[model samples]
Target: MAAKKNILLIIADDLGRNLGVCGESKIKTPNLDDLAAQGTYFDMAFASTASCSGSRSVIQSGLHTHETGQLGLLRGFQGLHYFTTFDHVETSPKVFNSLGYLTGIINKVHVGPAECYPWRVREESSTRDVAWTAQRSAAFFERAKEEDKPFFLTVGYIDPHRDLTRGGFGNTQDYPGVEHLPYDPKDVTIPFFLSDVPEVRQELAEYYSAVWRMDQGVGMLLQELHRAGLDESTLVMFTSDNGPPFVNSKSTLYDAGVRLPMIIRTPGCTPGIVNPNLVSFIDILPTFLNWAGFANVKGNRKGRSVLSIMSETSPLDDWGQVFGSHTFHELTAYYPTRYMRTKRFKYHRNVAWQLDFPFPGDLYGAVSWEGMRNAEPAMIGKRPVANYIKRGPEELFDLENDPEEVHNLANDPEYNETLLDMRKALEAWQLETEDPWFFRDGISTRVIFNHIDAGMKMPDRWDFDVNSPGSKDGAIMPHSFKEVRGRGAM
Candidate 1:
């Protein structure tokens, strides 16, 4: 029989496509670049949400934020307590532990309920010190070796993330072997998502330095793995919780936010293959469970493992679309938006488009934000601040043509057929996932199902009033998901 493979999942905080392998040559990421070369690099991977705690929760629970009940940051978002997954949601740690893997997390476990994530070794260090994390992870590996058990260790590096202060990125301290000054403000490429200003450039410089330190940490961990004679038996995956900490990124669900990197070095797989599969954070748990021999995968874990097609160069039939769900970032940033992104088109349903979008605590006070707000153009990249904050209820974008998502074609008669098709597909997904955000007449269908079951006639148009769209020719009746699940929604 083959030896069971160990899992080393390294999650970088607030990192975007800054690595060279991801086509960002300005911000050097040698460790990640080499790791991508050593295994399959998924080109189109996404997070269920764009916030830190919410994304990590999705990674662990293998479910969307709507299903997991992680509506916002899990803890200490501006010293205000937030929420976590329900106790019933089985987290990655809990599953791997019960299935006989020695589960341990080195830093930044932003999930909840001890029973859900019963980590055998949990070190809740919020340190950006990579060496300490590397040493701790190695020690955990040694313990697993000592007990003759396969292991699952997560090294959550808090580098490249914003510090408590407005423009800080935890880069004030000198590291042992990392380059103290990785890049200059003029050298680092300003992402298309941010404005070109002094504050934004300087912040990117600091952010680059922090990412450099995090890469050093990655190199150290890989070195430890090699030294411990576990290189051939371990599956190493490197990913980020969300996009970079920028004004237009991080907390929003644009491609800059929800779309992130997924690099995996599975044992005995063909190296240097670029898999174009559309994957998600929810797939992580299923992949681990697949490695750990846990079967009977059903219910709310609405994701399949990437193990079957990790090295496939071309996109598969079923790997073409992904869903995104977001409710809040802090306790206050409650702009609920759900999206369905296919290979070419993206559709968004902004549940709270009536209210202005709230910014996360850090982004609100960011220097980049301040610069853009006061700039002559007053833009976050090419997007107007007004259009960003006050979004439309429905939006449709042709990602192949408008990669930046600058245009909304929902109301355009030319794309009406395409828009309705994508909307139906998204609604069908909501029904299958039991998403509570599926609305009718400004109310959750699930929330008002009792009234519907008791024969309350309702306007069938989505979340509309009397004079709104499709209210005149209303398909008014008692609602049923089985009836509403539209055709071609497969």
Candidate 2:
């Protein structure tokens, strides 16, 4: 048999499909564009969740946020530790290591319990120093070459994630000999998810600057790989954890948030093909394993390898729809939502429709959001302020006509069938996944089971507070600290 192919999976933080190859004229990404030209660029790739850690966890584990229990960030201030990964979970690194491939990761190690992800080479940092990272990766590549073993190196960059300031995207730093082609606010194209206010324009300009730097990083890494003569033997994949780091995009279930840029350059595969299949981050684990000649690596995962579809230029019949589950952004931002998106319709089921949508810390403090929030009635581009925050239980959008998702067709008489069908699909998925927060009558079914599992009497009306017993209505509230603590309902 031929030599096993190596893997280099580069994940960009908080980046959307706004690259030059993806038809965005504002930013310059020649290296990534060239890669797209020399590889297969996927148009409809998406993330299971929009948050950083949760999305990364999904990609690594081939499991949804609900399944992995990494529903939010690993940061402590948020008290979202309840959603952290359990020890029993299997990760890509674990499988790769067991298969005798030298697994390594450089920078931004966000997801984990340490034991689950046993990467042989773990260089963790949160800096956006791309050149420095490339040098470090070069050292790792040299080591891999010396070892004579096929390697799996994951390079996670901190580019394009929001900086400390509202309008900064890590552009102030000066890297050696790196030409920072600055973006003009006037020249930047505004995405539909945000209003075209001065603040938004300014922020987008900074964002473009960060994206440019990230593209430079990509160029440097690819150059290093070619120099080491590992380019052809490697299956290189470039993608992002989630969407852009802007309000209504990063934490939302909309395409602007979950939809990402995915380009794969597999060894001996046809290049420059655009596949518009509905693929997700979860599909990546299987693809990596399959490409590494370990297709049957032991793991129970929801994703399947897309190696067959990677070379296809036209859309495939089986690649029709995708599902998304986002429970929390922060522990405080408890908006349990699920979605089923097809070519024409996108359906969203917001479980806690009665409560107003919570804002992420970064988005809440953003000047762009301030501009829209202080506007007449505060509109997110064309969407109403009320619609942005206070959503109903169900929402359906005809993406073919209303690509911006500004119009809701859930209540429309013409779309009742579509709405019902999508709702049923989402409900069936929730049941299959055994989601703890599968809301029935504002009550989590798993919480009801908690009582049964605990050997406590099942409430007749299901009207006992999980918090204070006999307080009426055994509701499992996420933000209610006392409730979740007393009831042990995550």
Top-TM-score structure, candidate number:
1
Candidate 2 worst ten-residue window by lDDT: 475-484
Using Cα atoms with residue i matched to residue i, what is each candidate's TM-score against the true structure?
Answer: 0.94, 0.91
Q: Per-residue lDDT for 1-490 in model 1, tens only?
A: 7586799999999999888888988877888999999998989999989998889889888899988888788787467757778788878887777778899998888777656778999998888888888888889889999998999998899988999888999988775655665578998787888889888998899899988888989999999998888998898989999999887789889999988989989778889988888998888888877765664654558888898897799989999999989988888678889998888998999987899988888888988789889999899888999888889989999988898888999999999999999998898888777778888878788766555655666677566674654444545454365543332121
List the global CA lDDT of all models: 0.85, 0.84
TM-score, predicted candidate 1 vs. hidden true structure:
0.94
lDDT of 1 at 294: 68
**Colliding pairs, model 1:** 441-463, 442-463
Where model 2 places Cα greater than 4 Å from the true spot, the runs are: 76-83, 449-490
Please, what are the lDDT tens digits per residue for candidate 2 over residues 1-490? 6786899999999999889888998799999999998889999998999998899899898889998989888774446554577677788888888888889999887888778788999999878889988998999999998998889999999998988777688888888856677888899898988898889999899999899999999999999999999988999999999899887789899999998999999777787889988998889999998898778874778788999798877767788788988988887888888888887889998877777888988888888898888887689978898888888888899999999888999899999999989987887777677677676444676666555444443333322345555524443432222223354555
Error of 2 at 105 (Å): 0.9
Error of 2 at 236 (Å): 0.7
After superposition, candidate 1 runs with Cα above 4 Å error: 464-490
Write down the lDDT that model 1 would get: 0.85
lDDT of 2: 0.84
